[model samples]
Target: ETFVSRMNLESHPDQPEWLSHVNASVLKVKLAMAIIGISSIHLLKTFINAGNYDIKVLMWQTIIHVVFLMSALAIALTDRLLSATHAAAKAGH
Candidate 1:
């Protein structure tokens, strides 16, 4: 609530008319990421418990997981940046 109040008081410099508001799409994406991240952690633990650990396989899995997770995060951030640019343009900034 305090953050929202402060944001309302400080309009975008380039587009004074622009107001910060809750973005449902962004929230949904974040929620999905949290779910997937938690599930991945649980699966990793289960894999370890299975006691058939192969260093080669585990290393590959870890690498692939990190790559995909980073890519997803990059895409999400890029989407946000693009949306902000578009909004500024629309506001005649």
Candidate 2:
């Protein structure tokens, strides 16, 4: 791909890695997911108390939110498990 070729050419071969790559990628997803989760809670609450929105629309929205939020949750959960395993290996029990 063009993007990959450009990055490979630009990056120095001796470049030392930093934490930004992981932090930036993970935190971006985390923040997005947090926002989605809050929105889902708000939507569910509205449907519960107000009962003004159409049931079909609400159902669709809830399903979408669940799917999106689940994706974020899955990524975060996997990261945590991997980190735990890494720590355990480092600790060497």
Model 1, position 31: C-alpha lDDT score: 69
Pick the lDDT winner: 2
- Name the lDDT value of residue 38 in candidate 2: 90
lDDT of 2: 0.74
Candidate 2's residue-wise lDDT over 1-93, tens digit each?
Answer: 244432352367665575325554488676877889797788878778656877787888778788878878787788888879989999996
The C-alpha stretches of model 2 lying farther than 4 A from their native spots are: 1-22, 25-29, 41-52
Regions more than 4 Å wrong, model 1:
1-35
Residue pairs with clashing backbones, model 2: none
lDDT by candidate, in order shown: 0.68, 0.74
TM per prediction:
0.53, 0.51
lDDT of 1 by residue, 1-93 (tens): 344434445544664542355465566567658856875895588577656767776777677667667766776888788899989999995
